[model samples]
Target: MKKKDKFIIIDGNSLAYRAFFALPDSIMTISGIITNSVYGFTNMLLKIINDNKPTMLAVAFDSKKPTFRHKIFKDYKSDREKMPEDLASQFNLIYRVLDVFNIPKYQVEGYEADDLLGTLATQAKDKGIEVLIVTGDKDALQLVSENVKVIFTVKGISDVNIYGPEEVIDKYGIGPNYIADYFGLIGDKIDNIPGISGIGKKSAAKLINEFGFLEQILDRVDEIPAEKIKEKLKQDSEMAILSKNLATIDCNSPIRIDIEKCKLKKFDEKKVYELFEYLEFRKLWEKIKKMNLMEKSLKDENKFQSRTKLIVEEGELINLIEKIKNLKEISIQFLGSNNDCTGIAISIKPDVSFYIHIDSKEKEDRFFNLLKPILINKNIKKIMHNAKYQLKILFKKGIRLQGLIFDSYIASYLLNPHFREHKLSEIIQKYFGYIAFFNIYSNRAITIYCC
Candidate 1:
């Protein structure tokens, strides 16, 4: 039997930028400092650990100075603008988080993250490690080896398509080894790599896979039927060479750090807890304390035990209402669909130890009947991660939640609007420092969180 092996690598800068722009420019630290990118980036890293039980992990970042590629092609990456001033400020906080997680971060002064990733993928493959390179760069495709796979973030880091040998063939219509040649023939407009003038993506893939390389395709110009392609390849010979050099990733950069430095370790709860407290994340504080009990069991080596803490039937109505009446404050977490919920599946918790399911009409009435009395009273301060959505649904049910107090999502946004996402699941993952989850039932397109 072949044992499963997973070696994870990340493009830290790319992931952070994608996450930063994915949400609104919200989420901030105390004292009016923005921490949106910090929040989003940290949650992404946590997501990978909680989902994939990778035996080894590393994150690679770009150096401040120009890489060797820039020296080769002066215009290489020249078109891109500087990162937002707000985003640049939060970069260090993300780095501190990596340190807390005991994850290895690799960077070389003259080498880009692609170089570090290429070298690591090659090294891991030699040692029988199955590498999963997480990056937004297409240049990392060249690093895909037989034992290595690439997971490109598709939409919002919410979904990813795993590209192995077969997937590469299906997706790009070329193998890993031929990606450089393909890039060489068809230029990257983003990187300013000048490819053959007339040759587009379709022609480039065919020529690269058929002739084996950019140089070889040029050599056999007589065989190429397309006169435009032949002329472009012949006339732009210098551009082809430059493009290949730009496209080919430098695997032998001087960044010789070991993966041992990147091992996932215990997050300093005190540091994270202090940060949350400083931000006034009380619900977040509670979630963290709860997960601390299961921290040792969840982190490191990428695994966690998910179990049902409680499940109440439709008949357990009064017991739940009786439970809610005594509580002064509560955290409301709505599960099921985000849309209209008359078919609204709701769950309300007056306390962490007690979560009541309102799946049926009987239980929901008792839960809301108790909740309705409080809706009119302004003294009873209420808290919900997303108060507006809950407000909309609860209002439809004749419950006007008048005096809502706080929203972790809103607080997180004010702290750093650039930090963007606001799902209960992600908020828990970020501020609470725990992996928030909902076991999604595909048929119903419904998500139910198992606390």
Candidate 2:
């Protein structure tokens, strides 16, 4: 027997809405594009992709037109508030991001995202594809079964509670199949769907669990021990049935499932990086950069040319700083972590760069003492990639660099923003069409120098 491949279906609109609310609306790029919703949705997306390692994926979005449920009641989800303009603005960007990832997205004019997900999940499960439906809606729990599970966003965007049929039973005191029936009796106030006038959760669950489904419960409503409960069920019988119909997800959406199109593929890194740059999603880019595929993509390092001369001795460091003191423009790369840096690399020209090892206190002191003046001088331009990181490393040594004339990182951000990393290798290959070759040692700092 072979292991089954997993197919992950997502409710895009619901999760996007959930994400918009989960994060602060103030999350925007420097250019002033709101990204909280996209951030939240992407985080959930990356988490699911990484955690599940699903081989097939699809995201179903809701159409603007009313679904069949609305046609049935005209008031289905009518009470729900319209989406805010801020959230509406992010949908396009989110869709662009999805397209960059090569993930298939589906939307039908007459159905909700959940309905599409339910349909796809059913098809996937029947075909022996292990199906996982990811959504922020509880109504999705109705689709949970042995082969199909629901990953429900519980509190925050990333925080989720997975529900199998057994979990659903444990949660609601009824099986997954009876979730719609439960809602039909109690009603969902969020959607303005009406149920029996006086029925509540406890009564709904008790009736659904005992008699199985709304129709069966209605068939035996006359035998209820409580007259008030029985009377409510009988009086609003039509409402109970209507709510059940409303609650039940249509597992028969007209949309076709294209497993080939949805097959998990390498994400378009350039496009994703571009979006991240425009969104000013620095941390998110770093996370994406660490993906295994990205790591593999970075292995093609033929374009890099080694540019720095290693300065192991204190005298060499003093000479390097002396050369920097007279230069009009210079680039420096700090080689170390936040706690401790091992060395620095300086590039005075495209081909002429120097590296200084700061292993000893005397060498470190000499390097900073000689270079500090040029950094503070208003004339000599300081150029570097991710200048803030270098500044932080230098700040750790009590040196405040001032002549911040150019930051390639900021320049690149202004230019494209989506390039994966501002490392010399990428920058050179991108702009100069050349490889930037440099050796990275365990004991040395990682730095890129540009002039």
Candidate 3:
């Protein structure tokens, strides 16, 4: 199917509520209202938005009632505890977030989100749209089809398993129909489905493969499978039937959702900022600001062109070393492909911000070492963002840099780890809120002259 026809539906309440409890609850407003779930959910939504670049999206929520699956099996999910009052209360904020992002949210009166997802999956398939249903629940696997795929969230909700026919086959060793059958034989303790007494996943799969269907296995019970298997299947005939029914998702669930209605629209940054301000997300609020929610920003004075002049000429080495040693604290920035021997640029800031090129190893080593005394000096401070990588390089060279203060990188991350990559350029932009380096700022400098 064409890309435009693609649709993505998320199990919002399931994942959002999960993210809420996954992180520490220390993130709160000064008033003692918790915002950890809000922040984490927002970050997750932002990442999904950026990655999927979905043309259409919607978040589906589950109803409070026991689903039809549970009616068929009373003990289904009976083990689950009730939702926390704090998390339940936070649902209002998530609802408002949906409004801010301009994405439609849906919650049926009497169905779980999984049933809604299955309903939507069936509808999207009819419309010729490739559907991607994302959730942490593996039970959603029953919805997999040629036109619809299930991407189960794993590894702390960062990655997903894209289950098409092949992936489903590879993983469960059964098709969706057989999947319900497979689970029927094995039973799910969480959902409380009970299979045959002696039957497990392996035996179930083997039997299903041999007979091709659950009814078929029982139809030819005398085809002489193991006596143990035959006796168990005969005795728990009711359980086997009930297990299959419980495992099978109701694609024909009465949840009447209009799939076309889930089409996405541009996010409402203003609304987002308003809620962000209410929750005290100062840094994220500013990030939304720079995204130009107003569409055009005011004219400012910090515009300066970065002219990288590659110096490949010979014999200008001594003069450069002398100039660097005479300066105190250099602001250094490198630009090139290979990080190790990449082209380097260094300059001293405040009045004499002249950038010198370093194309040779001799130059790279010399400039890095020149700041050692300042880096190790308790009275002096050196600043960097994502200092771990850069510091590792320096440490490997036996250049132990201690007493350094102000890592703009970590500061930027502590501000918003979800906004940008932990790169220096991003931190500089976040903290300074402008491209200050081209003129207002410069690169890392290495040492001694009182500039």
TM-score of each: 0.64, 0.79, 0.64
Candidate 3's displacement at residue 321, Å, is 41
Candidate 1, run of 10 with poorest lDDT: 300-309
What's the lDDT for candidate 3? 0.66
Kindly report which residue stretches of model 1 are placed more than 4 angstroms away from their true locations once superposed.
Answer: 1-5, 276-451
By lDDT, who's the top model here?
Answer: 2
Instruction: Give candidate 2 regions above 4 Å deviation.
Output: 293-302, 305-344, 356-438, 441-446
Candidate 1 yields a Cα-based lDDT of 0.69
Per-residue alpha-carbon lDDT of candidate 1 for residues 1-451, written as tens digits (9 for 90 to 100): 9875588999998888887887667566546777667666766766676677676889998988998889988999888888899889878877876765667888889888888898888877887878899988887887786788888887665567778878887878888888888878888987888777778888888887778777788789778888888888888888898898898988787766475665555666656655554554444445545543223432321222222223345445455455546656554555544443322222344113333444566666665675577565665556666777777767667777766778777887876564436666656555555555433332333333323
lDDT digits (tens) for residues 67-180 of candidate 2: 888889998888888899999999998998788788999999989998999999999888889999998888999999889999988887878899998899889889998888
lDDT, residue 255, model 1: 65
lDDT of 2 at 266: 89
lDDT of each: 0.69, 0.81, 0.66
Per-residue lDDT over 40-126 for candidate 3, one digit per residue giving the tens place of the 0 to 100 score: 777677667667667678888888777777666778777877888878777888888877776777777667887778887887788
* Candidate 2 weakest ten by summed lDDT: 295-304
Clashes of each: 18, 13, 12
Q: How close is candidate 2 to the true structure, as a TM-score?
A: 0.79
